[model samples]
Target: MPKKVPIRKCVGCQERKEKRELIRIVRSPEGEFSVDPTGKKPGRGAYICPKLECLEKAIKNKGLERSFKTAVDDELKELLRQKVTSYEK
Candidate 1:
């Protein structure tokens, strides 16, 4: 039997898509934010599409903040933008 694929919602576009098709942003137990390419990192994770528009939408809509349940400051947001921009296709 085929393995069941996981599903994740993009914090950016708010779209429900297969987990593999999205990029994951993980907040480690130490409260560190980083991108999880493998999608298996053990921590709170938020997903976003591989698109710049979605990134902007997420920032503007406070989607990431809601997902992480914390205030995402300007520096962190800038850092996230840099990391996510590289992942954009």
Candidate 2:
């Protein structure tokens, strides 16, 4: 029998994809937000594609904010941008 791969939806593209193919954005219990490369972080998580366009679309559409149930400030948005850019490299 083959193992089934986990799937998650990209907040930006609104497309279902393999979990490993997506980047995780986590909101800690303390209300801190960061990109989780391992996808094992404990907190509220939102998945997104690794592309910059997806990141931009997520930001523009307030997808992260909606997922985290908090207002995503500019600082956090910038940090997410940096993380996504670094991941793209």
Candidate 3:
């Protein structure tokens, strides 16, 4: 039997991609945001590509804000940038 690969859409490009190929951002019930690498965090989640371009587009388009249903201000944006870069290493 063949196992099915999970698919998710990128909030930045709105493109469908394999789940393992993207990064996930989660908003805890307590309204805290974190970049989810293990993809096992319990919370509302939004997916984005790991590319910087996608991150920029997501920010400019307010994709994260829409996904999280909250204000994604400068501080959080900077945090996301740092976490993403660290993850890439």
TM-score of each: 0.87, 0.93, 0.90
Query: What is the full ranking by lDDT, best candidate first?
Result: 2, 3, 1
Rate residue 29 of model 3 by lDDT. Answer: 93
Write one digit per residue (lDDT tens) for candidate 2, span 1-89: 99999999999999999999999999999998888989999999999998899989998999998999999989988887887898799
Best by TM-score: 2
Predicted structure 2, TM vs. truth: 0.93
Please report, in order, the local distance difference test score of every candidate based on alpha carbons: 0.86, 0.92, 0.89
lDDT accuracy of residue 89 in candidate 3: 78
Q: Output the lDDT of residue 76, model 3.
A: 77
Stretches of model 1 off by over 4 angstroms after superposition: none
lDDT for each residue of candidate 1 in 1-70, tens digit (9 for 90 to 100): 9999999899988899999888888888899888888878999999988888888999999999999998
Model 3 misplaced stretches (Cα beyond 4 Å): 87-89
Measured by TM-score, how close is model 3 to the native structure? 0.90
lDDT of the structure predicted as candidate 3: 0.89
Candidate order (TM-score): 2, 3, 1
Worst 10 residues of 1 by lDDT: 80-89
1 or 3: which has the higher TM-score?
Answer: 3
Question: Candidate 3 on 7-89: residue-level lDDT in tens?
Answer: 99999999999999999999999988888889999999999888877888999999999999998878878987886676667
Q: Select the stronger candidate by lDDT from 1 and 3.
A: 3
